[model samples]
Target: MASIEKLPMLAAGYEKLTAELRALRDERPLIVDAIEEARAHGDLSENAEYHSAKERQGQVEAAIADLEDRVSRAQIIDPTTLSGDKIIFGATVTLLDDDDKPVRYQIVGPYEADAKAGKISYNSPLGRALIGKRVGDEMEVSVPAGERFYAVEKIEFI
Candidate 1:
């Protein structure tokens, strides 16, 4: 029995990966054509085209394997299905740091992590600290810089 760990992902994230996999699969014919053309050029020992084509084939196969592994382990969790007041996966949270400055972030899976977009992975230090917290809850997180305190201002599922 091959057991796969459940990978969490947002619908958009899942769709994006699916599209990438589809594009890779669609490029298979072009890769085959390139290999055939390269082989016709003769002298196998010094053929750059042939070597490049083989390298491309290896890259494509590796990508396919990685994508398959991700898809197999995926456990899609819809944000809309959640009904909770406490912070949990897919929940957008607003926190006030010790300085009284507000920072907003959404807890998502590793696959959907995009710090620039305000999406943090649940496994991250900050995200882990925010989990199970409710509005008005004060918590301290130990980061590389030092220990920082934050108060949960709001929790929303979006």
Candidate 2:
């Protein structure tokens, strides 16, 4: 049998996907009804509404399938339940720069990584630099803007 690939993500991220999947499932009947109604209007070849509804149905089905695949293969890991001294997957790390400014980031899977929200993916440059780092360990990271330096100040599971 082929290996069952696992994708790690936080509990909240998994919950979000579940909610999206549920919404997509709920929308299926509405799309079906639309298609039926559109078909009743006239010849399908000339009907724009029918074509649009059919296209929408296809899109919705595709989204549902993708979300289901991701969720089924997910290996959910709740950061709050994890504890470690060194930065690792699901660890929220706090770092201080040369200017004494603090920046916080949580290492997560690529699917759940939102840089704006300070959740960095393990595959990212900064995340790779921070991995396995303990408190007081300093490292320089090369970002798009320039090279930045930071010292690990704290690591928390939450």
Candidate 3:
């Protein structure tokens, strides 16, 4: 049932989230020990360590729950499994701006999108504009700066 509505998440992102969830689960014993030790130290009314441990426990549990849900809902796709001229999810594209400046970007899922790494989320403005476009296609994307024009130079699903 959790797999019915597939969530588009990068394979790497899914692996990272599952690893984090495992680490959080491993911290259960430590959190329990901290709480028990704190409780043994003093009264319920004035216990800083106890309160801190309880808060940390709540945070860890919440993170575990969220990560589990995300990992369960993720639908992983390998970029190499694709072969198309048109831009789509996991497609790396090269573009030439109106000013002749060259730019490259890989359209990826939201969780794995890192602008600094030249990875853009498919839901992003530029990514949306690039979708369904092939080499030699011209398009304009509206960004915070302004509308920018680009000509698709290449598409790679590597």
Best by TM-score: 2
TM-score versus the correct structure, for each prediction: 0.89, 0.90, 0.88
Among these predicted structures, which one has the highest lDDT? 2
**Candidate 2 runs further than 4 Å off:** none
Query: What is the C-alpha local distance difference test score of each model?
Result: 0.90, 0.93, 0.89
Q: Put the candidates in TM-score order, highest first.
A: 2, 1, 3
Of models 2 and 3, which has the larger TM-score?
2
Number of clashes in every candidate structure? 0, 0, 0
Candidate 3 residue runs with Cα over 4 Å from true position: 1-4
Candidate 2 root-mean-square deviation in Å: 1.6
Residue-by-residue lDDT tens digits, candidate 2, 78-100: 88888878999999999997688
Q: Write the per-residue lDDT of candidate 1 for residues 80-146, one digit (tens) a residue.
A: 8887889999898989998999999989988789988999999989999998999989999998889
What is the full ranking by lDDT, best candidate first? 2, 1, 3
Query: Model 3 over residues 1-158: C-alpha lDDT tens digits?
Result: 35365668678878887888899999999999999999999796799999999999999999988888778888898889999778989899999997989899999888789989999999899989998999999998999989999999999988
